[model samples]
Target: MPDLDPPKRSRWTLWLVLLVCAAPVVASYFSFYVLDLRGRAYGDLIQPTRDLPASLALTDLKGAPVAAVSLHGQWLLTYVPDRACDEGCERMLFMQRQLREMLGKDRDRLDKLVLVPDDVNLTPAQIDALTAHGAPATVLRAPRAAIEGWLMAAPGHRMGEHLFLVDPMGRWMLRTPATPEPSAVKKDLERLMRANAGWDKPGR
Candidate 1:
């Protein structure tokens, strides 16, 4: 019988390659989670981080399908609000845009997202306003239940009240209070950008 040694060696090699590719992400997360981040991080860290759900269905205003996994590769600063673009929702969108802009050169490393729940549609004017700023946010419609399942709100608080942060690896990790101060949130964004600077890069 022919020797099977070469095939087994090739299999082991493949496993090694995968492990090597995953090392940087694993190491960075370990450092962030295991280290003394409690006193350092501004946003509340999610204990046992949640991965973005595969079932998260998203669609553009035109009704085109968007893969949930496609959302990976860039840090996401996300907000979920009702279909109506009320004064409060507009205020949050403004703040979210400001937060991303404040990142300076690192701005591209993060993307702003607004998840509209209940499959409701946005009016033409609302879409225009959302896309007005030079750096427009990616607004997509998602199921209300799906958003609730993936992101948790504080006790007695609605999910829309808090802003969420998802890492490049697709992990929903950090969250801010309902009325988040831009300055304070900016600090947290800076800290996160600094921490993952090594492995994370700009763009999706």
Candidate 2:
């Protein structure tokens, strides 16, 4: 009589493979939501996150329609300012560039979005500053009222004072303080990137 045992070896192999594939997703979830960091996010994580509106329309400085690439498929470091582009506005622009550059090899995974209120103008110098961040540095004209509803500012502050982090899924995930501390903001960015390593990659 031939031995008549179950195919335990094949069953074990299948289970092993499934575990390996699921490990990353489990780990990512734990790191992002379950793990208890000393003080939550370095930048205040927006409680009850908001989604980027699909119907909201934005145009470039010349009044041309903006591209979809700016709003989706990559993490966004966003700033909104009045047309004047004052000293504070210029500083925030520089901060956005600096923070993205600080991401180093992961920099390409991020995009900078400057929402131009219809009342505001994008000066030549401002345009030059944006160009320095490389391709797809988005500067677009959008309805101030509409955009404000999505990205909330720090209490007692205007929208321009804050820098926002939009997840690849088009959600407003985090908002840095009115006066950003680069080190603090960078900590928040690095943590998210590390946690999302399982699903997120350098490009898009």
TM-score per model over all chains: 0.90, 0.81
- For residue 27, what is the lDDT in candidate 2? 81
Candidate 2 differs from the real structure by a C-alpha RMSD in angstroms, to one decimal, of: 5.9
lDDT per residue, candidate 1, 101-147, as tens digits?
A: 89999999999988998655667787897888788889888889898
Candidate 1 clashes: the total is 0
Candidate 1 lDDT (Cα, 0 to 1): 0.84
lDDT of 2 by residue, 49-133 (tens): 6888887788877788875445778888999995488999989988998899898888888988888888777778778778663
**Prediction RMSDs, each to the true structure:** 2.5, 5.9
What's model 2's lDDT at 2? 69
Off by over 4 Å in 1: 1-4, 119-121
> How well does candidate 2 score on lDDT at residue 57?
82
Question: Residue 198 in candidate 2 has what lDDT?
Answer: 80
Candidate 1 RMSD computed on C-alpha atoms after optimal superposition onto the true structure: 2.5
lDDT of 1 at 109: 95
